[model samples]
Target: MARGKEYGYLLDGLNSERAEMIKRALRAIPEIKSISIRPSQGTIQLIATKDPETQVKIACEVAGCVFRLKLGRGQLA
Candidate 1:
């Protein structure tokens, strides 16, 4: 069976540059399966195999950004 989980995050106070940095940071971790970002809404939607909260926290720290847990439409899968 597939054991993957999805998570959505809403990043505040981020521009294109900051979003890029965060993407790189998250991609560096193997646990992060996929990453999607919306610059207009500052939303980062991710698919992770495990421990998404920790992974996102570290990525945000590395990127010097802050985020909140906000699930968008159809993001709970």
Candidate 2:
């Protein structure tokens, strides 16, 4: 998919079920190449094209979560 930027976030009240739902929602977004969740670490990592913040926010909303901390941005390996 020629993935572009990598994004990471700490979403409040994260759990395995919520993370699973969030991942499902994010998959529907074409810009997102992939999604990773570190439940033990409370991290959500995304490899996406263009700007995914807004869509990420929406996906989180659908999962009943709000971003608590932005883990920052980076390039996908």
Candidate 3:
């Protein structure tokens, strides 16, 4: 299996303040491989070995906003 997977999330309610909260929430989850947040554009990029849906879900939940999937790239062999 691939060691990592990358996904992008477009969140509705993400700002500088809530971005920190989401960061903390993602950090607490071991399944998350990495996270990059763009507070200006309200975009979150994540690398995770687990389910992408779950990762996006948690991010939206923690940010208290609706999530729209912006991008998903499959692992290259």
Quick one: best TM-score, which candidate?
2
TM-score of each: 0.76, 0.82, 0.75
lDDT of 1 by residue, 9-58 (tens): 77777778888988888888877888888878878878778757777777
Local error of candidate 3 at residue 40 (angstroms) = 1.1
Models sorted by TM-score, best on top? 2, 1, 3
Per-model CA lDDT versus the true structure:
0.76, 0.79, 0.75
How high a TM-score does candidate 2 get?
0.82
Report residue 72 deviation for candidate 3 (angstroms).
Answer: 3.3
- Model 2 per-residue lDDT tens digits across residues 1-77: 56587788778778899899988888888888978987777788888887677877887788887777677545222
| True-structure lDDT of candidate 2 | 0.79
Q: How much is the lDDT of residue 5 in candidate 3? A: 70
Encode model 3's per-residue lDDT on 1-77: one tens digit a residue: 55777777777877888888888878877777888888788788877887666756776786787776666454211
lDDT of model 2 at position 22: 88
Sorted on lDDT, highest at the top, how do the candidates line up?
A: 2, 1, 3
**Candidate 3 TM-score over all chains jointly:** 0.75
